[model samples]
Target chain A: MIAMPDQPSRKPLVELRNLSKHFGEGQARVDALRDVTLTICSREVVGLLGPSGSGKSTLLNAIGCILEPDQGWMRLDGEVVYENRWLRGNLRRLRLEKIGFIFQTHNLLPFLNCTDNVAVVLHLAGWKKSAAIARAHELLADLPVDHRKVAMPGQLSGGEAQRVAIARALANRPRIILADEPTAALDSVRAGIVMDLLHKLAVEQDAAIIAVTHDEKILGRLDRIYRMVDGALSS
Target chain B: MNLAFRDIRHKLGRFVLTSLGLSMLLGVVVTMAGIYRGQTADALALLQATRADVWIVEAGSHGPFAEASRIPGDTREIVARMDGVSEAGSLTLQTVQLVQGDRRLRLQIIGYEPGRPGGPATLIAGREITSNRYEIIVDRQTGLLPGEALKLGRRTFTVVGLTSGIVTLSGDSVVYLTLADAQQVQFDLAPPAARREQARGAARGSTDLVNAVVARVSANIPASLIAAEISRWKHLSALTAAEQETLLTRTVIERASRQIGLFMTVLTLVSAVIIALIVYTLTLDKTRDIATLKMIGAPDRTIIGLIVQQALLMGVSGFIIGTAFVYAFRGVFPRRIEMLPADIAGLFVVVVLVCLAASALGVRVAVKVDPARALAG
Candidate 1:
């Protein structure tokens, strides 16, 4: 257990109520999620720990609006976003404007340079090429290896690639960042650096973060921890 | 960001190799078109070289190529005396096999009067035939050089001149001979066959027959009028030079033209299949990246555009390279290969359409990629 922060309480930035999801059918069916409920406030770093097939990934996908739950209610920034079914709006737009995702492996496109990978999101958000590129350069300049902005993903080191992925996730300045094992592939030193970066991003940008990870060593630095077993969650 | 170009640059070697392979296929397509054009040109080569205003053949014949139209050889003199006739010559066309050393070569033997219509035009080497006996002018395609001796029937003829682009409607190499020699070659039979025919009580056909009479009309008179006058004789048919060309191309070479059309269709389909396979393979190589893009909130159109743009680039590059390859080696082909500018432009349009169609397969694969897969790893 990690001690909770003593900051003033605020409405949850993201909320899930009675979320249920199942896969396959009959004897092959698996209840990936069972009425899971959770909440994380803005400017908070929450860690989720679970073994393989414990539904951590399923819950992340549901929150990211990529997968639908069999029965669910989801609220973001205290506004109802999903009830019985999703609200009548573009889910893709919602994801682009309100959510960010970082994968276990650095999923930067191998073809584009670091800046381009980051700028592509801004481009999708209707920014002009010059403005998006400027914003990409600004975000990259804040990273430790700003000189790698022009280097392709294949040319970047593991740490540099992860940092570039982080820059891409933050480019749109979404309210929520969903990270699935973002530090699972890093060394101890690089993992610590990444945890610190995520912590700083939550506080400075006022964004809520849910990091689904298997690394117990990094849990000490998070504000809260949730454990999932057999499709149920406990904090 | 231009992701297509970026991806290509990232895998420059693979992209270039694929483009090279595609270009060879495209080169074959280009060469096929050139061959069709060459066929048409070869069909018209002899007619254009004759430059005769009118041609007179036996009645009920559709020119000398489509059917045998032998008229009396003395018809040339009678046509020469007609009004508006500047010069008239007897022309005899026959296919003959000539032997040189151990090689046997098939040639379209054209017999014509010296210093008149129906002879090889524009010599590439040596001089035109000055003698009417056993001297011949051969097209360069016959693989004969000046002063080379070739056997025609029982007699040996010396090659006195070489001509370029002289071929029959069927793309056979042409050799020019005197009307008298062609008549003998056409009418004379082997000794045994002649003896057998005599014992059978069949007199040999007249050797004084010519296939057609060509006339160069005066500048002031229309060749059509002269042709109309010749048709009045009721025993012969006359056609203007344009009519003869039409008769040869549309009638004599009609089957070949259809075969080439079918060949072009097959090549185009093959090119489409090749492009489609290459695009599908390339898409398969990038399925992971495509899934990531989907997860990142990139719209399906963006991914589709990436694929379509790459396909277009490959098509254009292949077309350019193929055109260059064909052009550089055009003359080396045994038959003429004609690549016109208009034809190349048309080919570019066709290649772009093929690429568009080919990219549809990749687009189908990309659009089905599940974005959730990005979270798995």
Candidate 2:
């Protein structure tokens, strides 16, 4: 696959240039990410397709600031957030305030209900509990799982849990949404539903989303899809 | 914010069961502390009941307890003549065993001059001794009633009074008697023993010698000053009332208290370890959840707070339940179990500290958890 030829007219919402990350040393050394370069424009839904150990997850983690890249120039909303080896500010607070993450397992807090799980980030971002919960209910109402708003994660079905995770990601209205195989555990219908929801959220919220997945069923609906192999990426 | 509570609620049965187990351990700790205090109280009961300001014993003796102290029975007269001394009386202490019907009873026999310091201070039944020769005051624990005949030495004596909460450091019931009667019981020997003692060329000791002389000082004078004056005598050692009390507690009950104290300390430590193990197990069970929390941008404080808060709740609840359990069953114990408000408060503080220390185990595990694991398939 060749890299997408058409460059967006607007500044990319997220950009990673020549990022490199490695594990081990000497003969045992293995590059997990090899000078990976990519950009996601606002409202863009970028799909990362890879098998296990292909480094797509690594790229998502680096962008999410879960792990600092050994070398990279990364930007979010055209602001330099990571350059070389230094971060712009506190990575955790950056992630809390500006990045939203969805996981393959829909890692909703088991003890919390759907509304509470979604409201936690809002509360962390300084919203009052009542207001945050209200916002969470509103987001759930917009999603397909509004009826399960008060249900605990353990009680929700797989698709319903994924819906709650999406609502939680959008709680803070973050600029970047990172999803790692968000629909890998769902049936095709449920996977299509999650993909449609992600696309709808991207267009409506103008938030860039990068989802890593092996499910090619939703690839045609994505704005662009990148295939990763042996720590390298191609479109 | 209250995720810890939510998790606890989710596992309410397990949490409650663990708390109950922890509470039982805490109950033992509390009971041990109470026993230690109760032993101290029992040790000092006789001293406090005497209401004397100073004690005059034989020179180089810790009195009645650590070493034998045989001062002249007439030492009371000498102590009374000292300036600032308001009154003085001879006192004797000895342990005696007696057979009453089929039961064998051991008691601490206290000898005091009638109408003087060293008499039974509180009587719950009957009158104080009227006869200087054959009447005795018995603690209620001895199962003796007024008018009951108690045999000691070669003579049978009638119980004239009953007292409570008086015991020796070894936890024997205390019996009170006239100084002369106690002396006869203490020093008098059987006919055959007397003959043997005479053949051995051992002098028959005077029956008037008492263990110590207890004295009260006038309100204007300090007992320590009079004691200092008495200490100058070549053959006499004088201790202020406080010193005597300290001697009794430190020497008579010191080992017992230390044993109970050690037991309490170990129980507390065991409680902490048990809590740590439980918290660590709970954390291990929720490792993935914790990692997910971290991946969702929860700070280290939030994650640690979840664990520490749960541990603290368990500890505080366990302490309350344990303290309640101790209070409920304290009387069932054979020995006195004294739970003072101050002691209870102190134990609560110790429990809280132990709980926090225990939470450290879980906090370490939680903080070291890799948030990136949440991203793994």
Best by TM-score: 1
Give the per-residue lDDT of model 2 (tens digit) for B1-377. Answer: 58899889878998888889888999988888888888888888878888889988999887776678987778898888888998898988888777788888989989888988888888999998878799999999888899899988887899999999898777799999899889888764335787698789998767788999989999989888998998898799989989988888877778887888889888888899999999899999889889877777788888898999999999998888988998998877878889999999999999889989999999999999988888877
Worst lDDT run of 10 residues, candidate 1 chain B, spans B186-195
Query: TM-score of chain A for each candidate?
Result: 0.94, 0.94
Query: Could you tell me which residue pairs clash in candidate 1?
Result: none
Q: Report the Cα lDDT for residue A131, model 1.
A: 94
User: Which pairs of residues collide in model 2?
Assistant: none
For candidate 2, give the lDDT of residue A164: 93
Give one digit per residue, the lDDT tens place, for model 1 in B36-149. Answer: 889889988988888889999999887887788989989999999999999999999988765667777888989999987877778899998898799999998888998888
For model 1, report the TM-score of its A chain.
Answer: 0.94
DockQ of each candidate, alpha-carbon based: 0.69, 0.55
